[model samples]
Target: MPDAMKILLFLLTICLGSIIMQPSVAQTVVNKPSAATADTVTVRGRVTDAQTKQGLPGVTVLVKGTALGVSTDTNGFYKLVVPSIRAVLTFNSVGYATVERKLDAKATGARVVNVALHPDTKALQEVVVTGGSPSQALMGSVSGVQSQAAHDRKQKRGGVSVQIQGISSMPRAPWYGRSESYATIQENSFHTARKEPLSTFSIDVDAASYSNVRRFLNDGQRPPRDAVRIEEMINYFTYDYPQPAANEPFSVTTELATCPWNPKHQLLQVGLQGKKVETSNLPAANLVFLVDVSGSMSGPDRLPLVQSALRLLVKVLRPQDRVSLVVYAGAAGVVLEPTPGTRRADILDAIDRLQAGGSTAGGEGLRLAYSTARKYFNKEGNNRVILATDGDFNVGEQSDAAMERLITEERESGVFLTVLGVGEGNLQDKKMELLADKGNGNYAYLDNLDEARRVLVRQFGGTLFTIAKDVKLQLEFNPARVQQYRLIGYENRALADEDFNNDRKDAGELGAGHTVTALYEIVPVGAPPVVDPLKYQANPAVAPASATADVMTVKLRYKEPQGSTSRLLERALRGTATPIVQASENLRFAAAVAQFGMLLRQSDYRGSATFETTAKLAEGARGKDAEGYRAEFVRLVKTAEAARRPTEDPESYGVR
Candidate 1:
């Protein structure tokens, strides 16, 4: 709390580069997208790995809603048209950066978009947007990745390969989390199409992965890859990314490494830290923790986790921080109001008074909490509403539309929202994501105490202080050097290529020290096209770039707190060699995780990803595999592969 202490903390953090620092500014944000400028041409391309050159299958290619799209073939190449579309495409894959590709569309008829998907050594996950179920997305002019027509055309060249994999994890019946089949159109076990013809392709994660993670969450059994599902990873556990004092290790720092279930596996080490407040810091705080103390949250891993996690948070609060506790059950009411953070005993008492019963009045609780937050309005402090729940808001204004409106309106008052998700069964993950995005806040899942510490106590800066908002990435391909590119993941967040610099567009969030990952698969230029090409755009080069296309630049825009306008920051993509060392711990861990995500999804692009390959990859780059994340990854691979055949075979994942 003192100046000297703060300076000492900064010095220490400088020494430990990974120690997320306390923000320089006192920032409680009502986040928004950065500004946008027109008059730029929208250039698009696909991204694929440099290795296989396949369309890193199941990648996401969106340009915000302007009907512009880019998807790669089995060979990874994308196509799109746009004007002044600054950084048109945001290429994302699990464990890779949510990269923005901006290029000159003309001088290059077909640009070669090649990017090597990095591994996330820090276990960070790239955000995923799951739309209103594919069954409902029937009317848009979508890029066909799974349509029968597209399949037919491809089938004309290849064969259909379909396989439905199931698992038996429960040791009992029902086999609840068993199937990994996502409606693939396969022929004689060879090649085929994804279910949703027009929309994005869905990769069925290996059911065994889900079961493994589930076992960990439900029983702390520590199954392989048992701690995944970004939503759950962020929600189920609470990691304290507490405010770093003047001299304390910024926020709390924790790391772990352990040998996996695999006898040949080495170890997994995990490293974590809190956030740094960069500029214009504030002091007095007003936090409203809106918890769903409903019957639904009474599970072993649900309400209990919330209680324990919140208690930890209470421990980290400074005396200046204020807290409010609101519970939503049969009805919503404030259990505690504007209590000083220093009143630890009293706050814990209030938390203890919570009991699960009655129906959930999520709407009423939300409104009451918002009112209370605004009532004590700490214009100079953090004014936020943290919601903890299993998401079964069956009472009051339970409709999705109503909740969305409530959150959106609350966001207008600069009262940011943070949703802490818990437990399975009736989980409204999609709804939670929408609320967080609309409310200009972030979301996480709390599966256990360690997770709580990791999020709340350990890495608080990235969770709370938002640096660049509405950061949209578009990469223009130099067709002269590349042939095609396909973006990985982020299928639901795709934007119309032209929407790249559109100020009005809403985009993704970036937390302090938080790393986002995405991967692209690309084909080099001069490679013969697998399909016939139409001689369009003759004399493609009409004019030279307007001085902007020297190197692909990452364009970012964000509104200042309480300001109607937005500012911009542009960074040109430079440096030829990928800094394997300076790369954040997020890269390696995330890369491994992405590979795991792909394997679970049973992607066709994953050639030779036998158990041995997965184990070796995880074993090789398992950065700080803390809490055994890498070890767990290896275990899951083995479990999945063994689940395929009986006596511990390495070729299947629940085929038995």
Candidate 2:
């Protein structure tokens, strides 16, 4: 057997064995609970829908006035550790009236709080009443306006909406549909070094696109072509770049290797590693959570998910940090004042009590959130607003241009933004990205609890703290060594060549410990060009490139978070291309991701790329695989492959 296959099989065996042993470990009996105390109690129950008498899953059962809570499983079963028997348990779920039950576990040796919740008329009205289909019913229950808005957006963009399988328990609806919005992408064509020597663009630290793609793949659907941003997909995983030393905000690394899918082309990788600062050493934070309580957010995966996700972020807060809550529905208002991080319970309770209803006043919400942040703005602290929503903005400053202006004006106050998107169907992805881009912040999409933890907890510093802003990269290739080059991705982040040195031109922000990677597919000196050799070009190409042995000169410009002016750094790429197998794990893995994205989008330039090839490349480059992110990525790739597989019956393609 081949060595690589043998190693893969060995790893598979170890992983499967571990999975098999988990149940046994879980089944191990525990010592008898310490004598039941008056202060502590265990409560178990099953909740159901009052009308259907069917079990309700994902219902939040919380100890009233406290942060303690647990969600019911698929079987509507729940077990919670209550701090006291005198506490009241509150059951909350979208479209249902809140239910509260006072429990005294001591009085009843084994207390059971089985309750059925009734639907709220207002929430029910949010659903469009159409000929009943399981998918229609489920989707309708979420937001009528959202569906309409999606339809309008799709129609406006000269695209058609597509019907997708509803969540579990919903029958497919012929009329039910979902719409995705992405900024149109115009692939960068190869540029001859002699004709166009410099390639410049802004940096992108957002990984929302990757997680959003995962959500689609996990749901057994292929992501829309526009939704696949290759740059974001590659940046989602961290690269092993050297940390910046003294007097530098970041370090730069470069690698050249043969392209995996197209061996004829050479790949160049440029990576920037932001300086890492311990969370404790970072400045105190003044955070304002701007939550969307619009009717569209009324779903198990929307408001409830946001609440749960924010709790994880709260757990990481230091005592020096302060958080405020601002919720928007019909209007925006502050729910909680600036509360110290030490009072975590208070912050969590405020988050928990947020119920979804009413129209979305996104503009008003932004105004209020910025006002709140400004009121508590600490010059030395990390002041920012975190907007959690489905990106559905209906009321007030609704146009993309208007929203952009609002965010732009607000960012001048030195406060950053963090847009966390949740839910689907009518996701305003473009609007959210625009807001984040203009607000001088980052954007992330939360598809599930795991993603929530990955963003809000594991990458807390990078997601929240901005170390540098307006970062841009400009690469000048040597015509003597290179013929043509094309950037692999970052279509939407492209900037004018002059913008590289213009500090007034806004760009992207870099957070502490964050790393950004960009790739270029280069055609060496004699390679064919995409454009016809201009017969007698306006300025005949002159290749007097110096004998410095440099392939390209890289210039980076960025401003300190608080500085108005930018600083410049330069590096040069020199030497022949490295073999793929001998390339650094970071380069190989990122190349694999870019290949996967191109294949997913069915890009014409993805020469000979296949999912199988991408997966194999990634498997070999899964360095350390800490936190199992790379492993999860492998599983996601396989899931996408399965989803894209052709069935035996051609008619059954893309059908459940």
Candidate 3:
């Protein structure tokens, strides 16, 4: 501005200019910090009920308008990281009104934001009482009504129990706006072995139906008839079956026992024990967690539970493995790139940052997840996409048929899919099941944290690593020894007899260390036939092999995870049948489960099967009870019995 010699006045002007310019530079620094220089603020707080002041677990705390969030722990404690102290946070939980808070802009370091949410009256009002005949209450509604009445009586009597009668016919109305969907399940009928000697179906390793049914029972509601898949129920529990010998992927065991339901018939238990693979020896994994953070998943049981379940899997991740997270809600995007499992904290941080609120673009999410998995495709390793959602796809490619096609096409790339279904009321069980089936994967329903542990931790190998795919089972009953037979379940898994040998056909995936079981009820030659003899044609002469003591032949087809051609396994079951009381624990436990399923389904063929008998059988057969799962099954049977209508005849409930 001036030559120093020119004037002191020139120097004064330069000094003023320097002061103004220096302040402007300082303001710029304060307003916008460089990306690398910016600091993340840590936020900690608790979420509690407004009225009760009790801590609320699974409350979703989020940085408003962003995907970053965290769910409160069991004691309602939560800690989150935000870009700045000025960030706005939102807290959401089921049955509670959403709450929002803005942080102090002038604050520094970590911040604290406690929230107390009030009950949402509108949500509570969704379930209202209405008058209807008990018969019109559907499978599970009567029990709910009776429970409510009993509660009212207890309250009136000052906690002193009093028998409430004449209220058996009362029915509670269903909650409004539920959209859960299940494919119809028609019970299998007896097939005259003389006419149809073969039974064919895809082996279903999925136990989603069993847990889903248990959810209903625990809620004091009878599961929907179509929701009870007997095969899934029987296979959910582990059996003491021998492991496969060398060069085999699984071992097949067969047991024949007097049918607990119909003593006149026999129960044949077919168990497949997949060869166990130690976790340390498993191939490196390339996994893409396709998480749904849609509006529907905002519920505590949905996204929150998903986070907890996935965390369990993460804990077992090895350094050689890699994980990527892709989330979808109105759109699809990858929150984390392919990160090595060694970066456990980074992966977990990414998971904790997830928040739910938007429409579901499930199809788009699948596309992105597969693309991610393929980009980091690990040859000679496990490549898979783990999808956790409520199966509610409302925004894009929403139909079950559309999802099935998309998953089917994506699976051809050798990236398997594992659908972890959570939440209820709007759970699209049919869609999830179809996706898993078509995607050459398995599905499990996480009803509680215990189930999450069982699926992701206790049975880690069986949950994530696939040893065999396209597994199908076919049984040829010896018409000479068996007059008629019916498969206990696998209604939807039925396959054309020819499909067993069709290498190109898709079937179920068998995970490492997984156990699959199937039950068959057989009417021996001397038993009364379920149907009159065919008048048009006489039965063909029994072959020499059929005349032997062999009751049936079991044939199984399977393909290696990476193989195109299938391998075969076969075994013949002898006709000797042991009394039900003397059956092995595996046989008796499995029979008990099948009997309970029949009773629940009210199957026409459930001869002499009673809840009391089911309980007794399960109680006696709960050997080794290492995990207490068998004992839990017995408890569930008792629960179902207690919930049954008082006036409903035991015979109608599967008792002879």
Which residue runs does candidate 2 get wrong by more than 4 Å? 1-176, 536-548, 644-656
- Report the number of clashing residue pairs per model: 134, 2, 1
Candidate 1 per-residue lDDT over residues 1-656, each given as its tens digit: 99999999998878777435533333423233233333444344446543323234334454442223444432334554443334455554332334555565344344455554433222222112123322212211112112223224323434221111111233211123432111122211111111111111111111122333533323212232212342222222223333545542223222212112222111211122323564234345688999998888765456656876787678778777889999889989989978997788788767755667789888898899889999998877667888898778888776668888888777777777777877655666556655776776776755444455556665555555554345454545444332344444444445566666576666554455554433333333233432344477342322322322322233434554344455654434322222323333443344345445555545554444455665665556655433434444554454454342112332222233
Residue-level lDDT tens digits of model 2 in 1-656: 99999999999999999888775633553433434333677789998767545566556676665434666665568887776777887776544567789986458455778988875422211222334333323222121112233334334544322221112332211111465567888777788888799999999999999988876665455677778899999999999999997899899999899888878778999999999989999999999999999999877568766876887798899999999999999999999999999998788657756778899999999999999999999999899999999989999999899999999999999999999999887888999999999999999998765577678877888999999999999999988878889998899999999898898899999999999999999887655555677667584654535545799999999999989999999999888888899999999999999988998888988998888888889989988754546765765675576563312332344223
C-alpha RMSD of candidate 1: 27.2
Candidate 3 residue-wise lDDT, 1-656, digit = tens? 65665798878899999887775776888888766237678899988767546566656676654435666765678898777666777776534567889988777888888998875422221211233322211111111111223334324433321111111222222212256888899888889887689999999999998998877665445776778889989889999999999899999999898888788888889999999999999999999999998888866567756876777688899999999999999999999999998898788667756778889999999999999999999889999999999988887788777887888899999999899999887988999999999998889998765577688887889988999999999999887788889998999999999889999999998999999999998888777767777678875644334334789999999999999999998999885789999999999999899989888888887788899999999989988765546755776787686553324443543333
Leading candidate by TM-score: 2
For model 1, state the Cα shift of residue 369 in Å. Answer: 1.7
Winning model by lDDT: 2
Candidate 1 — which residues are off by over 4 angstroms?
1-275, 278-284, 527-532, 535-551, 574-589, 624-628, 643-656
Worst 10 residues of 1 by lDDT: 190-199
Residue 124 lDDT, candidate 3, scale 0-100: 21
